[model samples]
Target: MKPQTRFNRRDFLQTATAATAAGVFIGTSSASHAQDSPNERPVFATIGLRNQGWTITDKSTKFADFAAFADVDANVLGMINEKLEKKTGKKAEGYKDYREVLDRKDIDAVMIAAPDHWHTKISVEAMLAGKDVYCEKPLTLTIDEGKLIEKIVKQTGRVFQVGTMQRTENQHRFLKAIALIREGRIGEIRKVTCGINGATGSPVIPAIDPPEGLDWDMWLGPAPKVPYRAGTEMRRGYGGGVPLHTNCHYAWRNWYETSGGQMNDWGAHHVDIATWALDASETGPNKVTPVSYSLPVEYKDGYPTVSDQYNSPTKFEIHVNMPGDIPMIITSEGDNGILFEGTKGRFFVNRGRLAGKPIEDLETNPLPEDAVEKVYGGAVSENHTANFIEGMRSREQPISDVWTHNRMLETCHLANIAIRLGRELNWDPTKREIIGDDEANSFLSRESRKGYEINM
Candidate 1:
């Protein structure tokens, strides 16, 4: 069945403004007016309409009205808008800049799937604008970004749901694993190993012009400007083609300027789950040590020395010492899953499956029906997006709240810093500072490109 568009962008924004000014009372309450009905629901806008962005927006249509959309690539924006309109008969206003979407008072929320560098800026702005935020995983490109977003969310009383959907989704796989650990089915967990796979790099490629319809400058956002290199010059398997060099779209995650590669990509999910199970969401690893690591290209003083090749670490074996003397090892070897080694039992879980002694015991001993719900803090939703929607209505935090999510991101960012520096680094979680190593501490945050700076 096709969903009907009830209000255009301008009309929706205008109506929302007056209603909010009068304290008309929407959100989780029954309203006498049809316009304010939960049936009409909240309206949302999406930024960065690429692969993941498209998927999220499409899925979100079932729960909210997508009033508008924005993307640096005009081609992506047009294509996604057309698809949304065709699929649901609800057309969204398109914008080349995300700021335009934030400028609208009608938008009740925004789904941010922009690159890692842009995540903090847009999320903070959206919150200050009084919009709930649903931002994709690996929440920030740096530790400071995570802290900034957390602070802004708290200050604004905004509901922020990070893309670590495993907490609410995963079909109860991660929740079950966490439940076992929390319920004492797994005797004290000695160590947890998360194998997050590896990164891909390309040979040096020459600078070239960005494709038509792409706003290259806006796409670069907060990252330093560099010459655009068409990825066609580079080998496919090693490094991807154009957009890879300039840190745009698909290739941005592999570069240090925009992302933390697999460390943050997969680390954000698995490491986040690990922290949740350990009840260490507020505090993170005290010591991070990189045993062995490899970068695709040379780097000088933490910056990639080369421009053309993929620069993130390709392989790494890192050991992190957590608060309770629990050692967590993050590596790129073995099946891509998290392995929990505990005194009584052990288990492994990824998106696909959760297995081991604990799971087998569950069949016989049988966990209470509330086992998974307990891990979810109450009820599990149909999916991660549903949790965000529920949080928006109740003004409560979703399963993956920004503060705890930031703690997980801190671990991932610190691991990346340690790998890049090729040494061990001590971290004071309480002070949120690096201990004794000024050089290492310098990597905790980065200066965003002018005009894109994250401001309170």
Candidate 2:
């Protein structure tokens, strides 16, 4: 099979709109009518019903019913089912395979909180099946998957929202701060430094059989097959099974095959903010050059490792040359915050504090009313899930729409690619191709295991 080439923005938009028009999008406003009038609730299903899935499910209860739940592990399914019964006073059907959930016509939308590898496949398939999707962050596992998902979202006209929740936070005043910068509050922007840490190392463990009621092959999905390692530490340090299993669920973020490490994990948040603030949400950096990078010398706890066992970079400095502006450095330090260097002075923001020269200026400087409206797309919802439900009804794009998300994912994935290639590379955003680097280009998409190809 030929490798898929990236689609241009215009093609993506046209495809998406057409898909929506072809009965793919049952507008959110109609969702209530579609359900209540017909003795149904806008039937919704959740994939990977674990940590994030439970939260999304709880929040979505107001707009839709939890019609179904799917997970690779039975233990996870049992736990979520018990919770669903306790909370909703109703039972939801459970399945081990996500594809089974997608096959249901009654399901109008799907909330995908699966690991990175399953995100693209589940989302693309859900859209293809005429369902809206709320996929978890770091939208795709690869740059190619990002472009592919962007195209699928547009082509299918399905309301798709990447789970970059920071965009929905009210206290993270960075949204308003970014509007100020774009509105010339901070003068010409000079540089943006995004602080994101790297991945941690996995503990060595012997190969073992798949855990009970877990479909290990399905969990592997499109990734290359490897023997199951018992008690092997995965990324993010969440144990797979045994209290001592130590890795697999939450910790999967440390592995390149399962996660984009800090580049994708934190990049989904901070890099997204930087791109939105810089008014570069529709595009990405022209160049990504790594000035410095270091792998974990020894697998000390807390710090990330660069061992081949984990694909994410541990310590690195990535210089990104934005279009028509000073280059920005995305590093693994600076207290994991966003620092903006402008001609007037510098402003820094993170999950907590927002500080800079004349720090009080942020509160008083106030972004123009029109700018805030534009940034939030007119309707402001305090909740991300609510925004998706609202967007589903209004037929308007959500906060983390596919187009903007692809651009953000591109930045993080390119940084990872540059680190992996160990060389500077030029990216042509319009063409959506890597210039003169076939080796780097090859990494854009991976071959699916079989029977999982994304088709238009």
Candidate 3:
């Protein structure tokens, strides 16, 4: 179902003013009550308290207390514990396994920032256990996982928000460009170019014994086991480790196994904006065709040994055939921004800037009233996290709800699959299968270690 319509701008402003006055009165009366109410603050736990997990905790501090923390690595958990105590002035309980935290009934929600492979398992379990979840972007590791997460969210009726914060930032130039596209300021969007530049290669290092205070097996999780090597340091780079890990952490955008290479990483951001702007959230392109690609032919030091260490495509192009006459070309160039080719004029937008030949036209010709409403849909808040919190309270679908996100994810995943297969593959979105290609279908889901099957 589409989102419910509430009020127009004029009515929204009046209601907001009245609500502010009422909230002041309620705040005055509830000050004493809040002191006595133990549940006033929502209790939350964070799994995978590494890089992005810390930021999520910081953002949610006002809405909840960091009641517990979980991570497979002892070193990382210790640092998080110290930081949580310092920020909240209250010590939070810590656990090595995320499952232990999920078992707690008091924790109302969980912020999952685990690696790409662990997103679906942890999120599915968290929802089944009656906890709201905020999972990181590219929602799942594979197409099947995305479908499974969507199904479980619908079944449980829990608030599930994907961390696509671009939807939240009101001043984000890229989204504004999208609003302009939908407004017809750029006319009909005929094609789009999205750039995600490189691939991930294996780290060249000798195998070594696992470190003290680290559970190597748990860290591997559902992924196939490989011996500990200097390369393993690249996996957990948030602990102020050596430069090798830094490259891996920040450069995770390159890898195929851990990430969707640039296609899913940056594509999730830019391509999602294109889909949203085009008003195609419910359905996506029927076809994904890989036009061309370039991969390293040797491996350099810790880079792809074949030619470069990165196995994912360094350069590639894919075409998505949306319904009607709208078609988009998602490519890996033009300095990491979205370029929209329209009938009127072509425009480009990235983080801070939006530029084109007729850029001034956007200033004089505002987006139509109806189109702006459709884009924002009468929502007063633009903050992504706040939207999730509101959805948790109202039992409404969030701005980046799991259902729409899964659709975007399917497109991103398909690009990766097509590139890996080295051939164009037809997709049956309804069936969630690659037509007539058994080998391609097999890659839809990976083999989980004996204990990690997702029953749903």
Candidate 4:
């Protein structure tokens, strides 16, 4: 059924921030809401229940109830269904097709952990179906997809949260880091380095028949159909024993067709923090240069020339000319964290720790008492899902709004484009296009395979 559309997203966002500033008593406690009589917790269904999907669902159980789960892999679907029941004591229905989950009126929101190619498609349709969305990042496969999502979100008036959990989660370390920057502990901002690490290059994996009970076609939605490739190489200690070299499972990270490799995988997390700290969320860089990079396979015209091998960059260092002339480097070499170099002092932060001279000086020259809360807009939630639920109840957008996410994501996408083209790109952020480069501009959007177009 087509969901009724409202144009209240502007007011939705307005209420969350305005009510907070007015001291309306929302979020005074971790679970508190604005209403005197609160609504029931939002009912959630998760799509693409692979590794990250279940992880999000597990963390979100405190704020939302699970009604359904959808995935293309039947074995994984069954396994996760049992796990969810054990964890939440709810027997959520499982489906091989995600559309069934979106069609359900009982579900209030969806947590999308689909492969990168499917993020935009599933997210747009879920919003159109009257369901709020918490999609995994990097949210879109291309820049045009991001714009399309922003439009649909405003049109539907639904609360949307990207799974850039670092904004709200990560043990409050990232929040503290951003707060230190806000407090001017690091005087004048200079250069920032996002050491998001690199992608795992793959050896040639032999094409194999589709694994039993896996809907391969559904898994490849919007991406070009290709052979399912796997090898005897085992990727242990992560993702619960999925083959290490398989194109269909965790190794999908190494494929440009299914994901952006490390550029967007970790890049989405760290680059987002860098952009937020630089105060460049609403705008973007004017230049993106492929300073140094290495791809595992040959490419022609920005498309990989081979199959059965990972084509995304194995090593990369992207140099971006950010707004205000700040030089931001997204690179593979270094400790996995964001390093901020400023005129006064510097700090390094990631999920694990927040460190540096500025961080150390907090003992004597402390920031305002509400520093972290101010940076986070209010008291932090127990988790990102708590923030999303708060947004749902407040009729507001979550901390990771579409506009800011897309702005930072443009850097990652452009970096991927520049590396694939082996050149630099001049961007006009106001126009949201490549400057005087028609060929590069074409990379901003991709043609989805027929019959898998996004449902508006």
Among these predictions, the greatest TM-score belongs to: 4
Better candidate number, 3 or 4, judged by lDDT: 4
**Deviation from native of the Cα of residue 245 in model 2, angstroms:** 7.0
Number of the top-ranking candidate, with lDDT as the measure = 4
Worst 10 residues of 1 by lDDT: 1-10
Ranking by TM-score: 4, 1, 2, 3
Per-model tally of clashing residue pairs: 5, 14, 17, 0
Model 2, 44: alpha-carbon shift in Å?
A: 1.6
Q: Which segments of candidate 2 are over 4 A away from where they belong?
A: 1-41, 170-172, 232-247, 296-308, 362-365, 368-371
Off by over 4 Å in 3: 1-39, 199-203, 231-254, 296-310, 357-359, 368-373, 380-382
Q: In model 1, which runs have C-alpha deviations exceeding 4 angstroms?
A: 1-39, 233-246
lDDT of each: 0.80, 0.73, 0.69, 0.84
TM-score of each: 0.90, 0.86, 0.83, 0.92
Residue clash pairs of candidate 1? 201-238, 201-239, 202-239, 231-241, 231-242
Worst 10 residues of 2 by lDDT: 1-10
lDDT of 4 by residue, 1-456 (tens): 001112234544555457656755232112222222246777889998889999999998887789899999989899999998899787899888889988787788899998999999999888878778899999999999999998877666667889999998878889898888888888888999999887667788999888898888878889998988899877788774777888888878888888888998999999999998888887889999998999999999988888988888989889999989999999999999999998898989988888888878988988888888888877888888988887777666778888888999999999999999999999998889999999999989999988999876
The Cα RMSD of model 3 versus the native structure comes to 7.6
Q: 270-376, model 3: which lDDT tens digit per residue?
A: 78877776667767777889998776434332234432244667778889876564777788755777778888888887776788865677578655655544565
The CA-based lDDT of model 2 is what?
0.73
